[model samples]
Target: MTLEELFYLHNQTIFKYLYYLLNDEKLAEDFTQETFTRFLHYEKSIKAGAELAWLRRTARNLAYDHYRRKRLIQFVPFLQGHEEQEPISPHQWLLQQEEAKALYLAIRQLKLSYRDVIILRKIEGLSIQETCDVLGWNEGKVKNTLKRALAVLQKQLGGDWDD
Candidate 1:
């Protein structure tokens, strides 16, 4: 497929995946564009029917690399820039149940691996095989990590967990 067609088909998916992980719009857009740029560079090596997987893998790696760099400098106070969103109005904030909001916060607190699996598999509705492709993990690792992630989430949620 041509570059235009590839971008048209996968840009949203790629961007959403990055946004969900990073929660930073500018970074997501930057990485999404970079993924396509890298795709163009290595397009010849990608096999047929594997374009989406290849793009996703590239996006995931880019995000992880960015996260790694961010983590390294996170301790440098002056180097950090806060990018808070506009405050949620009381009405809008009240519209969401407290439990749901807490759950989301807890998810964000989980380790990167667990958070990635939960977001991709549970939130994004990707199948096991698809999650594996995006994460470059085997099915067993995915399943095991997901199980542990859920357990950690439950612990994080305290008695808020119904089951």
Candidate 2:
């Protein structure tokens, strides 16, 4: 597919994935753009049908690099009384809902592995196998990590989470 077509198809997905990982809309947007820019550099090497997975992996790596550089003590800025930015879209509006905010907070408290599995498997609705592809993990690792992540999330959410 052409670059424009690929961007149109996967942009929101990548952006949301990054948003969940970063918990900062502006940073997520920047990483999303960087992910695509890296794709431009490596497009010739990426296999067909693997573009989305590649983008996700790239986004995850970028987030990791950012965290390493910043050495942040806190991941969720909103909880720290960071000034709220006006919602720019329906998705942003949804993210501001009480439940979504609580969930994001809970997810932010998790270790990166748990956060990644939860985001990829549940929030993003990626299948087990697809999550494995994006995370470069085996099936067993993905399933086990997801199970543990869900349990932790449930406990963190006050054991009220249905799933």
Best by lDDT: 2
Which residue pairs clash within candidate 2?
Answer: none
lDDT by residue (1-163, candidate 1, tens digit) is: 8999989999999998877767778988999999999999998999888899889889888987986887731110011113465787888756654655677778877877888888777777788998888888999999999989988999998864432
**In model 2, where is the ten-residue run with the lowest total lDDT?**
73-82
| Residue 119, candidate 2: C-alpha displacement in angstroms | 0.8
Give the per-residue lDDT of model 2 (tens digit) for 1-163. Answer: 9989999999998887877677789999999999999999999999999999999999989988998899862455233224577546877656657676788788889998987887777767799889999999999999999889888889998966665
| TM-scores of all candidate predictions against the true structure | 0.80, 0.80
For this target, which candidate reaches the highest TM-score against the unseen true structure?
A: 1
Clashes of each: 0, 0
